[model samples]
Target: MSASNHKDTYQATGVFLVLMGILYLLDKWIGFSSHGLPWVMQKDTMLLYAAVIFLWFKSDKSVGIILAGIWLIQNIGLVIALLGQMSAYLLPLALLLVGVILYFISSR
Candidate 1:
């Protein structure tokens, strides 16, 4: 397939993922039983969706990677807090790691 076609496919897949996540959240909002951890968080879920959308549109992946990294840290921090293992350093450390990953990905 052509490069354009390949990019289109990725964009389509990203849209699908975001739509699915939104639908799931809407269902939960209406008191549906998700019966488990959400596919995404009630808070900061937009980061993931926006990251996917941005990644599809931009040649540089850093924006998406950074957003996704922040999202992951938020969600995981919530879980860790619940377990009483959360730390003040987690956010900085996670952000640093994400920045490194973004630099490497963008450099390629």
Candidate 2:
């Protein structure tokens, strides 16, 4: 990658960090309720945002995609709960599918 690309990547990372810090401060000072906030604004969404930034500004996208997939897998239960779905085995089944897919993809 060119120097410009490297600079952009660093700038994006810095901006993300700064924004997260500001959000953290706001949450602390204003006492925002986590349940009342949108899912995107939740603290756990930082990883998703960082993954998006990595995909957008980085030359290589594989790492970003992998991180995003992992985040989805990790939070699948939360997503299902939010959607008002109550399947006891859904989380495990989703995880198993993701694992199989990842295994196949990595073998190529």
Candidate 3:
């Protein structure tokens, strides 16, 4: 991508982060109930959103994949609880998937 394109991507990401921050602040200060809010609006979803944005807009995707993997690792307990004991296998499966994806991306 050209310099202008990178600049636009950065600007868009900055705007998105700013908007998320504003919403978070509003939720804290105004005591707005977040229960009815969409999953994307939740605080913990920011990293996932950022990862997706980076993967979509940037030429290099490893950072985005790493971020996404980190998010998944951090939320493993929750995932397991939701999916049951069999879900424990998902951790290794996810790691393998990430590794394969990274390998393919890096080989290109």
Q: How does each model score on lDDT?
A: 0.68, 0.76, 0.74
lDDT of 2 by residue, 3-105 (tens): 8877877876887788788877887776567547656466458888888877887776776788787788779777778756555677678779979998998
What would the TM-score be for candidate 3 when compared with the true structure?
Answer: 0.61
After superposition, which runs of candidate 2 have C-alpha atoms over 4 Å from their true positions? Answer: 38-43, 79-108
Question: What TM-score does candidate 2 get on C-alpha atoms?
Answer: 0.57
lDDT of 3 by residue, 1-108 (tens): 689767757865886688678877877776555456565455558877777777776666666778877887778778889989777787678779878987997999
Q: Rank the candidates by TM-score, best first.
A: 3, 2, 1
TM per candidate: 0.39, 0.57, 0.61
| Candidate achieving higher lDDT, 1 or 2 | 2
lDDT (10s digit) by residue, model 1, range 1-108: 578756865775677577867767677686344556454545487567776776667565666767876876678856567657445676568769868987997999
For model 1 the local lDDT of residue 13 reads 61
Residue 84, candidate 1: Cα error in Å is 12
Residue 100 deviation, candidate 3, in Å? 3.3
Top candidate on lDDT is 2
The residue ranges of model 1 lying beyond 4 angstroms of the native Cα positions read 1-41, 78-108
